[model samples]
Target: MYNLPGLTIRTISVSETNNNVYILTSKTSGAQVLIDAADDAPAILSLLADAQEDTDATTHVSAIITTHSHWDHVRALGEVKEVTKAPTAAGEDEIEAITVPTDIALGHGEVRSFEDIELEVIQLRGHTLGSIALLYRDPRGPAHLFSGDSLFPGGVGNTEDDPDRFLSLITDVTERIFDQLPDSTVVHPGHGNGTTLGAERPHLAQWKARGW
Candidate 1:
């Protein structure tokens, strides 16, 4: 749970994998966006329902955005989308893998705005070719990054031991994420818990050397 300036963020873990489903609601407009409909329709629905307490106006999910095309990240995509009737958005390169029809194809650096919140898409390749992270500039404090499976606390997402893919992933993460963003940025990962860039920034070279 979070009480940012104009936004309210609520996250729930679903499925055996402990996949994280995030609901971001604009306090002013009550526009909601569901991130990574990972699993358990009942739980996902409940999370959305619970988010209503954050705003005065009617809280409606305007978009269901997928971080990547991975099975764990999208298991409940159709059901959640059906229940909410929200338009879906995903990385442009992942349109085919995601299966669900994506109403908005997100590209790197593109700003996707719904209601008062605007998320900037950042493409972090390798865990999956089209894996992406969404950045929200909070204005009040540190920026928040919905980093999906591509990024986590310890290191980058699994590259399956392919050195080429691993390099591609690490390179993108180092440049697009570590280099561009500040150390205070908060990273909300696809699974497990959250971490800050400052906590992980010092290990960039180590992560690269380890070749994960």
Candidate 2:
């Protein structure tokens, strides 16, 4: 559990794919929002149960945000949604690939609030037509980015050998994420460990040159 003044971020790695399930909770209200119900239904539910202990209220998940519709990213979405009964949200273009119906179609610059915290949506293409990254800006600290699979520690997501897709992803990451956000921002990717923007910023040229 990562505790901030008003929020807590918890990460659970699931399945053989090592998909990362993120649970963002509001400390004051105990409102919770889950991102990417990845895989392993039993494991995911256990993590949710542990988080619920922090609140005396109903402790139900208010919403489930699916970063993309990739099979690995949503393998357990339906199961988790059944248990939590939380509204499911996903990018409009990627909705067709999701097994569960998307209650809300998120797009660029859209904001959704859970308790006192607001998450801004950023549309990033390449990995999929509607890949998105969620941004949470805390008043006292630097911003936090749930970058889905659009970014990772060494480089961006797989482009399937498409140069055009790689270009699009690079442009979006530069203009929409890197250019606008500070280097101090913490990035929690869809898989693997988290990294700060400062750590990955200097290697942009290397990533671009490698064309991954």
Best by lDDT: 1
Write down the TM-score for model 1. Answer: 0.98
lDDT of every model, 2 decimals: 0.92, 0.89
Candidate 1's displacement at residue 91, Å, is 0.4
TM-score of each: 0.98, 0.96
RMSD per candidate (Å) reads: 0.7, 1.2
Candidate 2 lDDT over residue span 34-116, tens digit each = 99999988988887778766656555688899999889999899998998888999888888888899998888999988666
Off by over 4 Å in 2: none
Please count the clashing residue pairs in each candidate, in the order shown: 0, 0
Worst 10 residues of 1 by lDDT: 47-56
Q: Please list the residue runs of candidate 1 whose C-alpha ends up more than 4 Å from where it truly belongs after superposition.
A: none
**Cα lDDT tens digits for candidate 1, 13-82:** 9889999999999998899999999999899899888878878989999899999998998889999889
